[model samples]
Target: MAEGGEDPQRLKKIAAAAYDYDNDSRWTDYWSNILIPPHMASHAEVVEHYKRKFYQRYMDPDLVVEPMSSTSSSQSARPSASTTNANEQQARSRSSGSVPRTAGPSATTGAANPSSVRWDQQTIQFSVNAWVFVIAVLAVLPLVPKNLSNRAYRLSFMGTACSSLYSLYALYGRPRAWNMQGMQVYFQSIVGAKDFIYFIYCLTFVTSNLCLKFALIPILCRALEQVAKFLRRNFTRSTIYRKYLEDPCVWVESNTTTLNILSSQAEIAIGFLLIISLLSWQRNFIQTFMYWQLLKLMYQAPVTAGYHQSNWSKIGRTVNPMIQRYAPFLNTPVTAVQRWWFR
Candidate 1:
């Protein structure tokens, strides 16, 4: 290996691993688990520090790296000549499509080419989920006028369904082959995927005649979780974020399990609500049947099975004895539902 110049062999290996974006190898999985704190990771200097090191190591061996302190911003009014030259070189490389670009300075620069400014699917998902969370909150607030609240509620689910579908496609592409076996496998994979389930769950109520506000609980929690992640990763440096949003974001990030549990509880309760709704004038038999099937998927899916199963077990313990003592005649029907649930 060369000590003072780019080594093609080493560069080739690194580029292969880095650019193998579609497949997750052990190397990728290992780095994915080692997370940086969002507050620190969001800073421009921190990102530049790593970028400078990467360039020095592989892109330009002679690149002079600057050591920036927390107070470095106050000490400089203009970049040094070396830094200016490096930025120009980077811009040229980007324009020539010779370098990989991220969603950073180059993405916003006026001279950046189309490829340099293209946003990744995760960024698109984040943007969509952020709006979903905002609109979901507005939909629930009583102070909002009824017409506005209705519009907000409808829009929130639409946004959530769109984001969920896009995420599903990003994670797993369309069926590669179109034969009967290939189509069966593709549809099975989609059914078992967590994101697809979410898509279906949100879409179920999108055009329904019944306005079941409880259905919003899962969408609200899921949107809040994703939006909090994006905000923490992108907005830690903003004055408004530091003053008003930091603590809440921190809390949401830390209490993800709590949020998931709350969502699961709301979802289980919603099944009972649907059953009760069947007796009311607002009944939609198709919606009730569809939601229960979705619930069954939530119970069976590996990602959500634990939360939903725990809630289901607790409900059984509470309700079984009540049926035995107070309403033994209802015992047969409850047993029938239990059989269907397990099947």
Candidate 2:
């Protein structure tokens, strides 16, 4: 120790010498040839001594040490040398290819760094416009009317067509050198939200189609039947009615019973459509809740499946009985209106 209980200069010299020796030996065979090789044979003995000392200090059982045989060590060097040569040859072969060199953090420092150019305002604006168009199309598709009120529905469909065309153009016309990561980032920036939005849109679209086909069509059919009945009773005279009544097949075909059967079938179709829509709504609600539950579980810990299973079991028991009771009605002839009229 020097003045103030410090040996500053001495410590600095020792550190510098150690650092220099490490760097030199790492690049050369200095330590391996002069120091390590001589002590390599006694490595197990040194390790055993340290292990025994550690165990004694801790009052633990002594660790067993197994020494490597000299013959094994000598034989290992031959394979190691052969592997090194093979690796060097492989490296040379790889270097002959046209793969681009990547700059690491250290390589990018100082004069090795390259300049980056920012995108122009026009390019940024175009990208923003493209993304806006994609989002608008996906969001509006489900809301478009089946019964066209104006030119808006047609316009919306055209917009979707145009956007799809643009997407195809962008996919095929882009530069081939663009890497997958860059393309993915580009797509995420532009229309990644559409993936989720489109799912909802498709559900709504299918539901709307079903409403048009089943509910609206059935109601329209019922209205047409009523109109036909009114026109037949009012416009036709007694003579025409008597002539039609003489043909029993014609009377049976146009009778109230036949109309009631048609209406009943229509009602069934509507019922089926409503049931499907109800199931879809329920699934959406359950999935939304499940997704939130999953997020909570991720942040905290796992939740038990018992609650979900119990609720579903209760629902199944309730629905199953109703379904079984109604199973007979599904095939039973709808005769209420006929029986009432006949009575």
Candidate 3:
């Protein structure tokens, strides 16, 4: 009814549509277009929370917002908090938290949505598959006879070695963008003999090519040294810095982004604790477990979460046929070996 205050229903309409992390509503765009604040925005904190959601979800930090023509109510609309605790905590975040920076239009081509649960989960899955494949290859290589004349032997060796190196880098995590200061911060966070043990565990399998009586001593010491160095790096810090928390395009959890980083670390630990051989009963067991896990994880990718999108039908149509075709190829070797040995 007034000069600038818009109808509550109009404000509700603008806010009701789900925000897509990839194609989002802009911070200033909201300021310009949606003049009516939602009735549920009870206080300044609620308004601040809404501001955080918009700026982080849509706008880039460097792109400054052009000044909007002021209206009767300047604050943006806010959604109702789902519960009392969230509302109270939000108040705290408003008071203590440094809200994410807002930019208007010329920020970098909108960066990747770093905090989207779906995005992070997908990335984690990819990283897991990558390193797991490498680990499997490395585990299987030791089983085959070491005959230089056998072309398969040489190819598998070289391939396994290269994959091993890449796995080390994957364990190292994001090295290029992470700096020395961050590394140092991470190092400082390491506490106790368990951390030292975990680091040593990583070293044992890394140097599996060596088969000396005391080889483990040097490897253990070196593992400790490298992990000590790794601890110093800040790239592993867990919490989203308060100032940067508002930016939806930025990562919230340092470790959770790609792969079950802790599990990957633990995988190296298990590799060190026991020697893996394809002939052993353990191999069959573990292989069976891995296959099930891979299939389960693969299927999960297509399951849409609340705000996440996926094309499960399309994915299944493509992968299902490939699985059926390859199933016999994988089983043929075991079947042949069984018949030959028994007969």
Candidate 4:
């Protein structure tokens, strides 16, 4: 009747009655708060216990007198229900040292976790983003000497490319089908994904000869956003994060749109900078061509197209008038590029 002191059948019914999984807001609330740590969410018994409590509060106050009182309850020998509040029971269990706990390494004691840090993809991504931010900052800081700054910039690109690749792999595993049609579908899906675009964006500059400081803006903004998200999710209880990092994290989340727009602007400006470099001896034609292709993909990809299309329109509006007025000869090529862009 009960596996690990919780009745599977009863919990399943309770969860079904309590939750409208199709309701976006309700499901989000249940998953984020009721679920607590993610590991417990997978267990039907734990989920049902919470759902029963949720049902009692909202749907029917007296539908089930004691939800946990089942055949397995007798097997586990838990005492009769003294409270309907699941959270209160958990709190009491913790205080009385009846509840078991599992955690990764302690920040202070350096204790080993049964499931070590390597198993947590979130933590790995967080560390990678944090490093990317630090490296990007070092590259941007005026105090850093030119040689070291250039090296740091290249390292930042390398780190971002690695992080993006890992994220793609973790999100979408390798394709099962390897044939022509199957591979075509898989490639299209990957190309449409936001992570794949970011990977390519970082790869474009990995071996570039130019050290344009403006190029790091997008990498820094993206790293800050990801690092802030990880901190908010995992370090909400930490005193250090609460005192110092919380406000910045909150601000970053609140202004994500602003950050994205800034990154888009920088990217567009960098394209012009590359064109200017073409007039000098430091131009890499291959890098410029590849970067332009990447930008074209960004403009077409659903996830990034909104921001990029708007930026490109603004640039066209401003540049088209100037070209038509003083550079009439460039009008034909500009029209050709516009046609290609729309196509």
Superior candidate under lDDT, 2 versus 4: 4
Measured on C-alpha atoms, candidate 4 has an lDDT of: 0.72
**Total clashing pairs for each candidate:** 0, 0, 16, 0
**What stretches of model 4 exceed 4 Å from their correct place?**
1-119, 178-182
Candidate 1 vs candidate 2, TM-score winner: 1
| Deviation in Å, model 1, residue 8 alpha carbon | 32
Q: For model 3, how does the per-residue alpha-carbon lDDT over 113-221 read when each residue is reduced to its tens digit?
A: 2225334543443443334334334334555454422333233333333433443323222222258985564333221222233233334334343322222332222
Residue 234 of model 4 has an lDDT of: 79
The per-prediction CA RMSD against the true structure, in angstroms, equals 13.6, 31.8, 19.0, 13.2
Model 3 RMSD, rounded to 1 decimal: 19.0
Error of 3 at 134 (Å): 5.3
lDDT of 4 at 26: 31
CA lDDT, every prediction? 0.71, 0.36, 0.35, 0.72
Error of 4 at 276 (Å): 1.5
